[model samples]
Target: MKNKILLVLIAIAAPVFFSGCATDAHYVQTGDKQQIISAGKINSQDFATAANDASRNLLSMDPNPLDKVDRSPAFVVFSKIVNNTDQSVDQDLLTQKIGIALTQSGKAQIKIVDKLGEDYGNIDDFLNDKKTTRRPDFTLSGKIIQTVDRAGRTRRGTYSFQMSLNDPKNRAQVWMFEKEIVKQGTRDAVGF
Candidate 1:
């Protein structure tokens, strides 16, 4: 009789155990209120904020490079973007957004560097002898840094995005911009 009661109890409990795991999946926009806030690592919102600030500051210089150009848009090549943060981050997340915004403004053009080619031109240029590629007027380079602080259950994180625009002709930084993003929360939470 005990064996029969155990089997009955097991049968009743099986569905209850499985029913607890019915979690629905949903999509959350970047920087949205529902987005999971992480105090330990950088978030998509941080990238966006950095991109916006860098683009604005770079474009609004006193002697606008793009406006100074009489002909086509001023060319810019992306230099090594150092990721000095604790978390692994795709550098494109920062550069691409700024590039798109700069491009959309019709002020600047970003040239993709080709490893095989000698200059910042298409890979096909490797076969051609003609140096048809226009040299970049400026080089853009930057670094991303992260800082963390913890006090008992409270935790804080700060991320800094720094960028410099260097003139290829003079090899001097014509413009520099930095944007800082900070997040704070409790350590009791996961990945705080």
Candidate 2:
């Protein structure tokens, strides 16, 4: 009797489990409907969305001012990026992506603020070469904030990505950008 019951249970459960997973598989974009979201940690799409926003703003900048000054684009030194989130995040994943996009667009250049290092060799060479080396007209930096709230069976999360471009020479912040991503669900397992 015990064996028959166990066998019957397994037979019923197996088909349901397999049938639940029978949807056709297909490729999906990073942030598309097929993407997975986890409540415990940051997701790749979150980073990608943030990167895309940053890239758009950085590239949209006018490179004309720097172009007229000679050849080198605006040289920027990375500033202190305050990670104001509860989770430990590798901030470079965000900054480096933006830096690459900015460099490729020819609108700005990225530099290390630290003055002492063998790494300075490249920047020094540019400064010495009249063909290159333009002082950074702007400094880029920002912070990320995550907030969570729970009501009944629903949970809500909001992640805010903020960035600012400051004119170091003038000691003024020129541009400020902020983007917030929010997700809500009846259970944490299904939300981001």
Candidate 3:
């Protein structure tokens, strides 16, 4: 009887001991179908999709500000991207993609605000006395909101990405867009 009990204990312990050794790690492309779908966090593809949609629509407006002027590339300034979600996100994922698309489309140039000014901290970069003044035709601002719900074993997370473009000269909103991305998963007994 003691031998029988020891054999059963080993049977149980053997799997547990080796389970921790079977971790699989590999690299995957962004937006790949193999990427883990979590109900608790936002993914990279979410940002890309939102940016693509907003940029596409923004470029389609009739009599768009970008085309009205002789300036081949209209200038723009990126303002705040307010994060109302519980998850902290880097804004560049969205802004950089949109900025690149706009630049590549030959429609706009997003001017980055220079914080160091003409001087460079301990050292200095004020070598050039000449200054070039460029003004942005528009400003971009937006907010991201999250909503989560859990019922029994099922959990869901919804994210809303909102964006708007405003004409700085007239202080009027020129365009607005929002994209909603949802992720759902059922909690398993194994706690994945």
Q: What residue runs in model 3 are displaced by over 4 Å at the alpha carbon?
A: 1-23, 113-132, 188-192
Superior candidate under TM-score, 1 versus 2: 1
Which prediction has the highest TM-score against the true structure?
Answer: 1
Cα RMSDs of all predictions?
Answer: 7.4, 6.3, 7.4
Candidate 2, 105-176: lDDT as tens digits: 876778744332224343334344433344555567788888888788777778888988765545567677
Model 1 error, position 27 (Å): 2.1
Query: Where does model 2 exceed 4 Å of error?
Result: 1-13, 16-32, 61-71, 112-135, 188-192
Alpha-carbon local distance difference test for all models: 0.76, 0.68, 0.74
Report the Cα lDDT for residue 118, model 2. Answer: 28
Predict model 2's lDDT versus the native. Answer: 0.68
lDDT score for residue 191 of model 2 = 25
Following a full C-alpha superposition, what root-mean-square deviation does model 2 have from the true structure? 6.3
Error of 2 at 153 (Å): 2.5
User: Candidate 1 lDDT, tens digit per residue, 19-44?
Assistant: 97675787656666655568888887
Rank candidates by lDDT, best first. Answer: 1, 3, 2
Ranking by TM-score: 1, 3, 2
